[model samples]
Target chain A: MPDWQELVRQRLSGLALDPSEKEEVHVELAAHLEESYEALLKENVPEQAAVSAALFQVTDWQDLQRRICAAKKRGHIMKKRLHQLWIPGFLTMGLSIVFLVTLQKLGFNARIVSWRDSDIFFYAPWLVSLPFLGALGAYISSRAGGSRGTALLASIFPALALTLTFLLMFPIDMIIEPIIGRQADFKIVAAALLKDGIGWMLFPGVALLAGGLLAHVLLSLRPSSRETAIG
Target chain B: MIGSGIKRGTAELAVLSVLHDGPLHGYELARRIEQQTNGALRFTLAALYPMLYRMEQQRWIRGTWETSANGRRRRCYRLTPAGKKKLTPLQREWAELFHALQRLTKVSHA
Candidate 1:
């Protein structure tokens, strides 16, 4: 007898079927063999002829992949949009609320730093971290629910955070600077960021590294079929 | 056999007709069509599942998970009421198209 299970697996190897899907294909192929055998016997064809005839009827895996890809491509735009608009926006809003509430609880003097010094501390690290955080957020969301959720969260959160932060900066500067009006000695900040330059890129460079790692993690977490095809 | 669009259409129709009988997994569906055609028609997986899924989206068929006699689970497809209704019209159109093709081919041969 033909090893129908093995035959089916071999046929399905090139196709991007997850374990469950592979098992499904196996059962279907085995059932097909039974039907093929019965028909061949009725026709008085030899067993080998029947098996060969049956094997010839199996569908081509490559064609199925192409079709599935085409279908996904057609429908994925809407999925991408939902991701871009909804999930990340929520994350950003949630983060902003937390930041605002925490800052409000802190006394005014606690935040009353020289405008030049505080602004540099507040904006500079953020300038580096926001994109880094955005990349991290994107990476997480990409794999969030097998890629779609990640893409949605990643796109929206960064945009939302950047917009809100920039808008808040003008008002925040006006409020803080009148009292202290101090500026950071740039040389000190530059030295702090550049100390590890040989080992890492300066401020922006470190952020970029975080973003790249985030992308890797995000890309790694996609569903098996897509990952397998890509690999 | 090699990129013939009309032949591909017939193959799809034949596959749909098999599904009309009941839900069969992909392999069984392919085998049934070949047997019915007496080994004349062959379906590739590329062609079969896409058509099946398309028909599914169109509400012409429905699929469900079923455990087979072999103690393995498979996704099987069956014709819906809508599919049955659509099938008649499609079958009629196919017949007309085939007839037209045959007549044209005959004239060319003559």
Candidate 2:
């Protein structure tokens, strides 16, 4: 009888699977062939006929190999994308929160409220860091097979979070205003909020756009041979 | 021989129905499916294994290694709760499809 395990390993050699995964497939195929061969022999079949019958089950090994490798590659890419994009994005957001808390502890809030000449100084630090954070998110997303839209969205995660928080807090602030019996210029507060929101997002948005353009240039310059050759 | 398109569509239902009763290794599953269908539905290893792996990935079925009485190790596949949940709807769809085909063909059931 032919060495079924060796035959299975040879047939599966073209697959791009990891070594352990390939070995598992090899064992499964070999075991399948062995069982089929034994079952045929039990029915009084000759050894040569049994071997042929067992091998006949794998009618198109090439097609099988192609499909298996394609599936494995897709799985690998998805896993890589999840790790590369989401993990770093969340970490960056967490670090930004810590930086804000540190600023508050350093009495930055008291200085901002006492502003006599300029309001921009209150947000200068955040503005300076926003572009780098956006660039980091865009770079990670680009490296993980994300499109331009994905890169932009990833970089704007902090903005999205801040907007969502403000939306949720707006109702509570309105309810507490009458209870506190404090009336301030609503128009001025609204203007400042709008201005600050725009200021906070301006650098990050520009950075994301620049990062996306840079990614596009870098990608187009690379050779196309790295892409999958098979359909 | 069954056409590849129809075979592919029905393969999942057939495997799930057979495995609903108990777990079976690859060889035994093939043998039982062929035997039960009177050779009408046959699965080549190349076609069957890939589908099995895909379903395993989907959490529809789980495969575990077990040693037979003869001390030979085999990977036996059993239907999961998820697979069982999906089986009823799949069977219903196939029945509906069969009825539609029968109606269109104007052929009475044999």
Candidate 3:
């Protein structure tokens, strides 16, 4: 009754949302206002009072505009994160997993070396393949305007994932031992973790991260890739 | 009347609970909440829409355009699987708070 659509458009104007998104908000708000106004009218309220009461629902139009605009903009940020970090990270992770599986299937036994009384195991083929996977992740992330940190992170996803798994394993095992009626010796567990982690997590993580960092540094040198970079 | 401060904390629960029934457009959704609370709780247009948008972005709820029986087009919102999953923890927390408050108030009144 109060030309609610026009009122909404005028009040919510200058929002930094896409044209279609702004229109969608305008229509929804106008409909809500219209519903309120009509419901008030049905209760024998005068036209002017109904309009006034309906409009009073929003105390600060400026704040409303800011909030709606910010909410819609955050949706865009999620999309950007998907492309810049998640997609690249997953792709690199998948590639490395595939490479590792192939090497295992080919009977490429992990070469064992005695390092500081630890039987350190290294899959030669998979370890060699990491530099390329790291490069792929870093290159893809930077091209998509990822920040230096995310690009580095994407490149070393596999190592990080392995490290995360190892870290979780310690806690999970500790929890389960008590549940399964066994006493977990904390000192023994820590010593075993330290000895095993040096071989399984630290060495591979460093190698993979080094490859990723090298590619990230090379990409950072290019001015075009640096322009849209965000952390 | 419930204060905005109190409502702000429970708004997600209110919206998600009301929407758990089925999809409803913005106006109907607001009306349902107020009705369920005996008009003690009302959502202003300013407060409701932004929270709705934020929740949709979070993937807790999904919105879609629909033409109702009266042929008015509006964006209908429905609870997602994620929203349903979130409801259990929220309900548990609120129940625990209510019990704690009841205990404190009884002690104070004594």
Q: Per-residue alpha-carbon lDDT of model 1 for B29-59, expressed as tens digits?
A: 8878878878777765555666676666667
Off by over 4 Å in 1: A58-140, A145-153, A156-231, B1-4, B10-47, B53-60, B69-74, B79-110
Complex DockQ, candidate 1: 0.20
Going through the candidates in order, their DockQ values are 0.20, 0.36, 0.68
Measured with C-alpha atoms, the lDDT of residue A225 in candidate 1 is: 33
Off by over 4 Å in 3: A89-231
* Local error of candidate 2 at residue A228 (angstroms): 20
lDDT of 1 by residue, A129-180 (tens): 4454446455545443435444434534534344445455555656665656
RMSD of each: 11.9, 8.1, 6.4
- Candidate 3 docking band: medium
Best by TM-score: 2
TM-score of chain B of each: 0.83, 0.93, 0.94
CA deviation > 4 Å runs, candidate 2? A72-77, A98-102, A109-231, B107-110
lDDT of 2 by residue, A70-183 (tens): 655665666755755575466556656676677778866522433345463245565555556666675566666566566656666676666665555556667767887885
Candidate 1's error at A138, in angstroms?
A: 2.3
Candidate maximizing DockQ: 3
Q: Please, what are the lDDT tens digits per residue for candidate 3 over residues A141-223?
A: 88887888888888888777876765666787778787978866654655565667756667666766778788887777888
